[model samples]
Target: MSDPKSLGLLAQFETPADIMHAAMAVRDAGFSKWDVFTPFPIHGMDDAMALPSSKVGFFTFVGGVTGFFSGMGMIWFMNKFDYPLVVGGKPLFTPLFAFPVSYELTILLSAFGTLFGLALLNRLPKLNNPLFSSERFKRATNDKFFVYVETADPKFSAVETRALLATLGASAVEEIHDTEA
Candidate 1:
């Protein structure tokens, strides 16, 4: 018997090639809700997996633009409109003075956006995971490659999925116990 809380079923692959092959197989077989884990990214895996273009770049773009505008606004407010003061006989709104702080703030905000956006997009900050308790999952960060078909997926069926994995050269298959949220 498997745990009822299982979120997905994991199938292990011995090599990166096997995982990539399985990715293709899964996509062609119309299993869209599957994820593959590897020690490192394999080239062309996304195509095989049929993954869509990521919006991470968009997040970065927004963050950068927001940072730039925010920097410009702050500088303008303090130096020009809000509290204009001539310093060293220079214009109240000196682009040179603004450039340094604006540049620095832009870089800083973009960096923060990258980190925070990635986490938010990935739904991370995961304090706990059932996979951690599973003896089999520990190898994910090490040498082995694995694929999982989430139960939330409409196409998920343990028996059929296991067979599909086996046909794709899965070395081993196991159930994941998804706990209560």
Candidate 2:
């Protein structure tokens, strides 16, 4: 009977400069529940938005742990478990041989962990979102940036939000809806 709750507003910008200004304006206005989308990352934008760096280091740590164990296991399997070999009179627990593959696996696993972890943490792979409905939002993949504030935020109100965006010099602002949430 009533328009579904709004996801937020989508303000599209034609250039990084406009987006940069928008970010600063949003930050200065003290709006924490917002994000910027750009064709490519722009330097200083993160600082402008005051976004903290992600805790991907924790993911890397998990990956490194996996890699270390896997590497050690492979060596143990080949040297001790399955095939015991005496090469050049070297001991079976030779760290030298294991180091290369082990190191490689460490880097590999850490990288995979970072990728998977980020995706999981961000809840990505979101192929469709209400932002897709805004005609101007298509430029995000080419040369546009956007900032959205969810209605769930305490500061959100159609009239007040529009007023804030206008004060922030948002080029164009339009409401976006996400019925399914």
Candidate 3:
């Protein structure tokens, strides 16, 4: 039988401070495939992890622009070209008349953009994770903090990374293996 594959190493921390420090160290060490888990959000964890700004805003902007133009174009085609009509001595097509519909469409599409953008960016619907295999990791949602370093990272050295986590005050450093075929 084939041996289980090494997924990564899971390091447990006793407090928010310990995990925060470990995150910074892991970030500074240049390990890319790593993550931190805590019972609740940490105030400065983003800065500590050195994460980049989210692209979800960009997606929302694009969706809004597309919706607005599409809405306006549809009204223009229906009023000005398809069946032009002069009412109350006013022009067949006018921005003032289309403004409300366009605005509504813009808001609708922007919401959809934000939802889909977040899902795509986060790699959602991830039904499973190697970390879930660790019984101790369950406490992450209750009262524990954890730093997980994936073996896929180029900077991940089994011995060195384990020692680094230990030095960073990790109470327990356990290896995570992928048992699935």
Candidate 4:
């Protein structure tokens, strides 16, 4: 089969420990476009996967700063410049009055940033994956743990990747083919 039509390989492990060891092996082998799926979250899997820190926090921080400043600016513009109103002997533009609005805006924009950042980072709206074509992969969300290595990875070799996973104690190793829609 052509390389483009081959999605990659799927290695199924009978247990979490087996998958964990397999994950470490794959990582050390320098395969980048790979992922592990478990019935539930696995502690230290991030370390095994060698995933870097998330960029979502940076987005949140920038959004919060922008929100706070924009809130302060908007209030100042409206109260001090747009329609100046001096009530109860208070200064026309006191930051104290804008503090509540700014605080709320900071939280609001931070939430928006987090949502968008997660979607962006994860390549969200991904309607389909070639892995979904595997009948055994359905077990991934139930009893089985799986590691999928994409053919698109720089280090991917059909023969070598399959052999590596098989040696890593994978109960079953299967090559996945893309399903054209």
lDDT of 3 by residue, 131-168 (tens): 88899999999999999999999999999999999999
Q: Which scores higher on lDDT, 2 or 3?
A: 3
Off by over 4 Å in 1: none
Error of 3 at 110 (Å): 1.1
Comparison by TM-score, 3 against 4, better one: 4
How many residue pairs clash (N, CA or C atoms closer than 3 angstroms) in each of the candidate models, in the order given?
4, 0, 0, 0
Candidate 3 C-alpha error for residue 178, in Å: 1.1
TM-score, structure 1 vs. true = 0.90
Worst 10 residues of 4 by lDDT: 1-10
lDDT tens readout by residue for model 2, 19-125: 88988987877776788988888999989999888788899889988998899899989897799988889888767878988999999999999998899888899
Q: Per-prediction TM-score, please?
A: 0.90, 0.88, 0.88, 0.90
Which of 1 and 4 is ahead in lDDT? 4
**CA-lDDT, candidates in order:** 0.82, 0.83, 0.92, 0.92
For candidate 4, give the lDDT of residue 50: 94
Model 2 residue-pair collision total: 0
Candidate 2 clash pair list: none
Task: Please provide, for model 1 over 113-158, each residue's C-alpha lDDT reduced to its tens digit, 9 standing for 90 to 100.
Answer: 8777889888899978766766877898899988989888899887
Q: For model 4, what is the error of residue 175's alpha carbon versus the real structure, in angstroms, after optimal superposition?
A: 1.8
Model 4: colliding residue pairs: none
* Residue 134's lDDT in candidate 4: 86
Native-referenced Cα lDDT, model 2: 0.83
Q: After superposition, how far is residue 164 of candidate 1 from its true place, in Å?
A: 1.1
